[model samples]
Target chain A: MNFQGIFSMSRKDLTTLVIFSIVVLALPIWLQPFGAAYPDLMQKFAIFGILAIGFNILFGLTGYLSFGHAAFLGVGSYTAVWTFKLFSMNPIPALIFAVILSGLFALLIGYVSLRRSGIYFSILTLAFAQMSYNLAYSVLTPITNGETGLQLEAGDPRVLDSMFVAEEAGLPVSNFFGIEMSGIPGFYFCAIFLILGFFITQRIFASPFGMMLRGIKSNQTRMNYTGFNTRPYTLTAFVISGMYAGLAGGLMAVTDPLAGAERMQWTASGEIVLMTILGGVGTLVGPVIGAWLIKYFENIFSSFNESVLHNLFGFLPDGVEGFVVELTSMFVGEGWHLTLGLVFVLVVTFLPGGMMEGYRRITTLFTGGGGDGDKKAKADDTQTQPAE
Target chain B: MDAIFLQFLNGLDKGGAYALIALGLTLVFGTLGVVNFAHGALFMLGAFCAVTLRKILTMQKVVLDEENLTAWGTPTEIRTTYVETWFGDFGTQLVNYSVPLAILLAIPVMLVVGVVMERGLIKHFYRRPHAEQILVTFGLAIVLQEIIKHYFGANPIPQPMPSNLAGAADIGVMMGMDPNIIVYPWWRLVYFAFSVIVIGAVFAFLQFTTFGMVVRAGMADRETVGLIGIDIDKRFTAMFGLAAVVAGVAGVMYTPLLPPDYHLGMDFLVLTFVVVVVGGMGSLPGAVLAGFMLGILQSFASMTEIKAIIPGIDQIIIYLVAVIILLVRPRGLLGRKGVMES
Candidate 1:
């Protein structure tokens, strides 16, 4: 329970962190030849990664599987859009407003929803999210702009002197501290925010507050009986996580400059849940990997066509060439969703700890690690020593 | 008053769907304790069954007549022959004359599908957490919808009602009103009647049959029932199939009300869940009652006056009611003691 000791990074931990940083930094360069605008996609990946990480704090750590987290995302997006519409096109103000608004919305939803746990909690959140989606889709069209989504307009007065001007007819207006909010700049801006989010999360992970959250997750009744009000700790974690989602949502709006009701849909919420579970629920790197994986598949697999398959199998038999193309095409493009679903099932069934755990197992196998074994032995030694 | 009566009937028709869907959901939830999110998709599949069957039954084969000669000296006659060879003319005639026949066909097909799904996927998730169960079923539902969409295309397919029951029925005249003022569709009336029979049959089966008794016992306590040597898993699987059949029949009957489409399942999923929750998690009677009550409430909420007071009340009334019910009585109307105790 020594805070400083826990917070102090070991040499191996520092080395791993540095390696991860280097990998993240070089990801865009590595992905450039793949026809993906690496920085933009990385930005998106990081944003969703942040969202999933926050979600994991509540779900993976606390065992509260909320089905309404996208509502917070939607709230953030809407808030950012509105800030642009009413106040300024400056990304700073817009994002700040988004985070605040989304946080408030999450606080309200979480307070009510947290009243019930387990299945009831899931149903409560699902109902609320659905209600939010429906209202946003139809009745609140004046605000959400209905199915067409809210977009940046030319007529909107740029009240802030530092706001970015639209470069072209269909360009996004973004002016954050005089830095042009065009393509690369925007991506870098989001990346910086993602790093900030990651840092905050890392700090929390090593903090006593984080320990309290883990304690609450492990045994809430015991924590309460041991003279601690657990509500404040849980609420704090929920709010922090909500803010992360809001920040992600704000970045989404900033990048695309549109806020649609579909963003708030239950499916959207479910996707984040999928990302969290797929990546490694409790691990920092897992959600990021999961988000990147899903997004990569969504963007890449969807674009696959007959020609792509033909190119891959040009060496096949002439008569069977068409069949190969047809078969491959079935598992690619629109059919890629089937593959994604299959992966989800397989992961949940076989790798419940997710891709991070897989990575850990590989590492442990290579290193001949006995970290877990040592901990178990130490516990046994302590028990024997006390008996003696 | 006439409008009210018409709305009431509309409510009943809609309530029939709610009852059927909720009944299915409750059956799965009660026996298996798996919140089958895919139930709506199954219902949608059932409606598609009618559409698929209708297409199959009406398929025409082109035959070339070699004996005939045209004016242009071409010995050709391309006559399209209706494939009435398989089923007699009467059977073909029945396909054209009644939509009710589709319901009969859909039930068995849906039952098989339900059984297959239970055996293939849901049976494994009985011991998993609710979240995983929800996610897996949700994934299955999405897979089902995507498959349906892939095969049927994205657009809603309009399945025509039988010729005899295509137009509005003059139910108003029977109730001492102008026939033109409050005309209900004959197919909808038939649907209502069919739902009644289905509900009655389900209730009767549960009330009077030995299998139903055992299933109920299994639902009340699977452990105790299993300890006594009843195959609870088989019974639960059968119950899942029964639930699927109910939902399928509902969808088949509802084809006239709304066209069948892949996304129709998702459109009704949340609302149906609301009905299930409002009815109580594992309470059958509660589900049926809540379905009817919520259905009527929704219809009433869609009234112009109600809309004027609160826009979008129709869409959200059920959820609001669910929240209120959950807040007031966490166990729902007829919820058992420890169903959601975790």
Candidate 2:
């Protein structure tokens, strides 16, 4: 209940937190050897992780399933790009502007959408996202640059103290405080921001506000009866989460300087929701893990071709081998979506607590598994018990 | 006045599509309490049925036509095949004049698919959270679309209308206006008529039939119906299939108006959902009415005058209407008490 209470947590909690932090810190190093290009995948994971974290604050804590979070991400990306075009090429100012812009957009959207809950809310968010996507694709062409996307123009005057000419080939021109910010340096910058985001989220989760949000999630009626204005709390969480999404979007553009209307699409919003759910809703680290897993699959699966399949299936006999390869190929490469869908179905239906629960179960298994099973059974029994 | 009439006609065609798709969505939602994200995919499958039927109808066998040597100076074996090899001779003959025939074919196939989907995938998800239901259905939709795309490439395949109905009808001349003023496509008119028939049939079936009575009872309260010893799940599955058939039939007829593509269902999916919500979540008649109103409003929003006043109004019109409806009547125009809450 107190800040110091969380900070001075039990040894078990402290150890778990420390272990998670170490794993996150070392994840890039562990992932570096699939090729020198693997860090790019890691950077993508971090960016999506940031977005998913923001999304969880609303979805996991408030039980509001938004199907339009991508609009905030798009808004953030666009604002960041615009900031770079008009004010400064520095990432900080662009990120700040993006967060502020996204927060404002989220405030407006959340207010209207939150009026109805459940499927209605989902549909509302989806409609708004679709509208945003359509406008970006056509009506807001001047701002969004239509379908071509927002890109760096060499002719734009930079008001920043630092001078760095736009790069013509390979990557965008970037000089961060007179040091080049291309390739690995750019990725590290994103990584630093992601770490900062995690820290902020960690603080939020351990705060009284987080407790209030959990209360709202559990019973809005009770909170209302207790004389608390539930709307402001929900609205605040929505805006904060929106700002986080904006920050992620800004980072995305900073790492790879382009903002496309597709970023605001309903599908994009769905992807984040999938990430949050896949990672383990209501858990601080679940979304990040889910984001990494999905991004890993996206990048790695797309790169798989016939040769890769053949090599992987080399041990099998000639006739059956070809069939096996064909079947596997159907669910890989271009067929990776099938696998993703199946994973989602399986997780939601069978493992509703998500990957984090699996991890928790494993940990429990190692430390006196017998008592854990009884506890779980009791929990399930309680869940099925009659409500008062 | 002519421009207005033509726009009205266009609105009717578009409204026909919204009504059909929204009707299907509402039926499934009403009976099963599932949001069915894959409804669009089912629509896409229905359109693909036309493409499949056409392919089957066109299969041929080669035959020698030596008598044609009078023109070429040499005898040649002209390749000809029996269309029946693909769809049976009856199907081939019907294909020539067969937009209606395609509708008939699409119905059974789409119905089977709908029933199978409901039984195999959706049945398991009835008690799951809305999010899970959405995710699974969304996955199913993606899988269905990808399978279609894999079988038929990513391009839109245009299906020809029946030859007699191919040309545009000169309605302006009949109305004592300039001949070129307002011409409506015959196929589109036919589609509108077909939609009306289907809509009428569905309403009639629900209103008059004993089976419809049972289904209506189930939709009103599944538990009550179940307690009375009716197999609600089976009936729900039937309703799901019926919804699929409606959507598929709409898609099949819509081929001449818009080419069938893998992504066509997705394009209509969001708009149709909005219509269903606006109509009041489980009300069928409300869905049909909202579909037409939104359709006309959308078309009107696309007008030059409206565009001049506010940009992108056409795209956002339905959503704006939905927001307004929610604000004014959160349960939608005809939503029953306690329906939209869950």
Candidate 3:
């Protein structure tokens, strides 16, 4: 097989890539109207987008619902931060070590966890993650720094940086060569990785390996009976996704420069799952959309105060306005999680394929495209249920 | 010997709570074949029932005293509970035992909640994929916790035990050992006894009653039971309600041991799942056995001597045991063959 030909995308995929790239690159401008254009939130949009994309590869394709991907993310962040402390503050080496280390971590975890399928697999992953979190919070305090988290400290040995440049003042900040990895630069840095991750996911989705993963998802028992060793394929997907989480973690460190044990908590892992399902499982762009949407809701909706609600409902009569504000307040601000939970339930109940399914339904309604809807139904029918 | 005995006692208390929660989870899984991720939320709701009852029982009436003046140069206010005014010492006693009393309130409320949950949401997903079931139930769990948090706020609400059981028990003296060597909290002991009684009642109910027999048969083969002219669905729904009641009472009784926060359910949810898996999925005895075993192991691992050797063994002991058990015996201690093996 020619490697060059294998790497090339079809015209449609190429078009999708180009359009996705443009839209992501223009997020800072377009998001301004929605009040999400700030650097920190934009960086999160890209970072978590990468995280969700990675998560989708495992759960979306292989149907292995991991509750421990956040462990890899935590590993990546810690590795990157340690690199920043020990070596140069350059993101290149930090990212490289982060991905490699997280990949190895994923390999060990996946090898053990993949022995079981269904909910057992999920439990194994969860156990491993919770252990990591607990250990990080207590016994691993020498490395993780306990509840204080790992952060860059001044007067440390920057073995690599010290070779040429003398120590200049305060705490060192992460950078790409000399480019400060903050503000718009950091968002773009994460965006590049997100785009790269998306492209890789798209290629994998189209590849034979991708088909093998999907086959394992559809019917692993049949695959095993047919003399296919599905373990290797599933393990490979797990590692790749773990590396994606690690990369996202590394990006998070680059943008914020802190690694906390909370990053590895099971709830964080659940959030990753939520993003994938909320967007559209098995679709290339769905995870990214889901990540962006959740982050947007978390940041934007949580920021809405009672005064903001009062202003918005000011057009109504005094009593009516007060009631409206009270009702809306429960779903926004501190209660934004309520809205998130409701949306997640509604999505799973109605749109099992998530937003992409909704999009498909809308298009089918307008264009009278019965074929796509039928294909979707067939796919839904074959979905692997968690074994009872 | 004293340390071991103390850890053993501690383990039994912790194990009782674990066993209670795992029993309900396993029951629902066994009867309905549906993994209810919201089981933990039921437990939380139960704990909040106690909190709500305490709030209601202690509702105070403020009266302005015209003859008295405050530092602010205004009339002083006298506060008295309406319960005290109406019923005197009985009301005070009622407020003192609010935690235990919440069990009565939690039973009916949790039954309705469980039935509604089963019929309205869970029934729709019975034929759907397990992944969808987990997702929807997880979402429901989140919604339930969030609603609780909205009313209760983020801080943990403490529930006081009855004044009679407030102090530590001299277990060492009773066992003919050194004084203060094995003192344990009275409430924890009471909790252990309470759980034992509840577990006994549930077992006897299942073993002796016709309803439980049918439910047990349905668990073994739902289609077969249904074909034999029994409405297994209705029984399963009842079983779900019973499971909720068990979890609710466990939470209600546990408030004196640990304060009830909205997030309490989630924290227990992960551990309870591990316990269930370790106990073997769909096995009631396995869940109970594993719960006690893990609880004891955890308490022992937290002993300074053990921690001295293994360093944070206490933090990860249960998970480590779970991992090892799962790896060594895929079906767990008492797991039957072909249950969730696919």
Candidate 4:
């Protein structure tokens, strides 16, 4: 339990990191069998995976639930889109600008929001985020382009556009040097960023800074009593997490080259919270896993209409099949939100550590399940930090 | 000058609704120490109660009118509401007053919903963290909203104002000013009056009644009340129901102003929570005061002169005020020290 050197991963940690990288890199093929290996869905999984990981840095470690994290994502998207609109079609400059701008935005928001803790902190962040969203939709229309969103057009001032070749048909796709950032290439690009994000997140967990954050989460009052200034640490975590969100947003735009104001809505912010909770809050890989699971379900389960249900239950008797499909359809397709809501309630009630805890319980089923008393202690530990 | 007066009137009614919503929110916070994120959902349900009642009262049956002929020379079919068919003129009057009638339906409906919500789900999370309460309630809110959406679809379903009260009231003339200069929508004025009555009644109930006294006492000290041989848990649960009733009635009255949509609850939930926070968490009077203040501020910000001077301020003014208030006075204007901070 010794604090490790900066940038150094222990043997076990390194093994996990490598395994994660391999799995992520091989997702294009591995996920294909699960019927979710399409490039577009893969891209979303990677992009959102990065966003959720960043969110965990603040929420999991510091116990600050930011209901406005979507604002930063929006800020990142707008910045990226503006870069594409004004400068070039290249994603590098757009992404860099996005990260820096959103980092600064988060810095200002965090500085203000971190002035208070608990519900006050949450409300403050929400207020700022809401303001940003409202402005993006209305007054900042010149910058955000209002409801139509910021999209690349046929003729624009792309000063750096001459370096890249335009496509023969339709709008030009975002590129990394000359490689088109669409289809499979886009997934790999996003996957690479996710891996890098995960790696950095792992480092933060092992570092002294991460411990300080954990200390803040466990007891800010005690930390203050012990003479540690918790504000700076928390703010720093907030900024880093914001930048991570910005990077994810940038990646999203890089793949699609569109930025909409709805992306900054409170519901969008709630999605990451749901993702974190569903996977395993504070866990190293839980948020990522959660993100993958949700994105997968949203893509896959939401597509299951009554027809799909009928097809799947075709082997059953006509009356029973019809009845079953009618009932099951309520949990799929447009009813996905209901399913998600039910899952959230159930998970928060029964599995506080989310799906990760469930996984652990099943794995340890033959090993006495750690027994009741020992399991409670472990559960409490995981409750505080779902992932190490 | 008249425009300003009209804006003030506009803000007052809106503020009244905000106050009512915030008052219920603060009630739950005060009594149960749980943030009921689904409070707005209750409000939406209340509004839909009006819609549902109207739909029921106006349920139609088509019959062929042999005396009337269509353009094609076939018998014309006339659709008459069953209420109209059964009760005649009285039923038509009933349909016209469905919004008011919905209050009666919403009272018991909301109480049941609130009790079931508390007993079925929220009861278990009493000992858990505030974060869990928020998450569970938020999820429940979403679920409720989605169910409503499943039944009614996502469109905003407008509830009608009674024909007699649909026009503008010329307050300017009544106040010795130019006629029609300070006119306000009659329904809005009625909403304001209704809100005041509701707010007054709630305060009076808490101020005068024994049940209110017990609830207030429970709010101040839970264990002490329980220690003294009173089952304060049931009282608190009732208080939660009361809060739900308050939110529901507010929503029921507000249907004529803003149409009820699935997302309506969440939309109001954020602003109402802001009002709760800015008023100072768990502070009822503060919630009411902050609600009115923010509502007025929002109206003022939306003024053309104000918007021309500070573009986009209209959209963000309430949130901006929230940010400022939270930073300057984290305990809120009427919030107690070390309430949620501890």
Q: Worst 10-residue stretch by lDDT in candidate 1 chain A? A: A379-388
Interface RMSD of each: 10.0, 6.2, 5.0, 5.8
Candidate 1 positional error at A388, Å? 52
Cα lDDT of model 1 by residue, A1-388, tens digit: 4877655875755665677666666667767786666566777776887798789888876777888899999999998988887777678888999999989988887887777777788888888888898899879999999999988786665565325444345434666766766577777787777666665677677668888988987788899899998877777787778888999999898877899999999889888988988998877678878988898888888888889889889999976998999776766788777667767766665565679877866776677777677744543342211100
> How big is the positional error of residue A383 in model 2, measured in Å on the Cα after superposition?
12
TM-score winner between candidates 2 and 3: 3
Best-fitting candidate, scored by TM-score: 3
Model 3 lDDT, residue A343, Cα: 90
Model with the higher lDDT, candidate 1 or 2: 2
Q: List candidate 1 stretches off by more than 4 Å.
A: A1-17, A33-37, A162-172, A363-388, B63-81, B84-94, B97-99
Worst 10 residues of 4 chain A by lDDT: A379-388
Please count the clashing residue pairs in each candidate, in the order shown: 1, 7, 0, 2
Weakest ten-residue segment in model 2 chain B by summed lDDT? B78-87
Output DockQ, candidate 4.
0.57
Higher-DockQ candidate among 3 and 4? 3
List-wise, what DockQ does each model earn? 0.33, 0.41, 0.58, 0.57
The TM-scores that each candidate's chain B achieves against the reference are 0.91, 0.90, 0.98, 0.97
Score candidate 3 by TM-score against the native: 0.97
Candidate 3 docking DockQ: 0.58
Q: Write the per-residue lDDT of candidate 4 for residues B29-108, one digit (tens) a residue.
A: 89988878889999888888888889899899989988999999989998889999899999989999999899999999
Model 3: native contacts recovered, as a fraction: 0.68
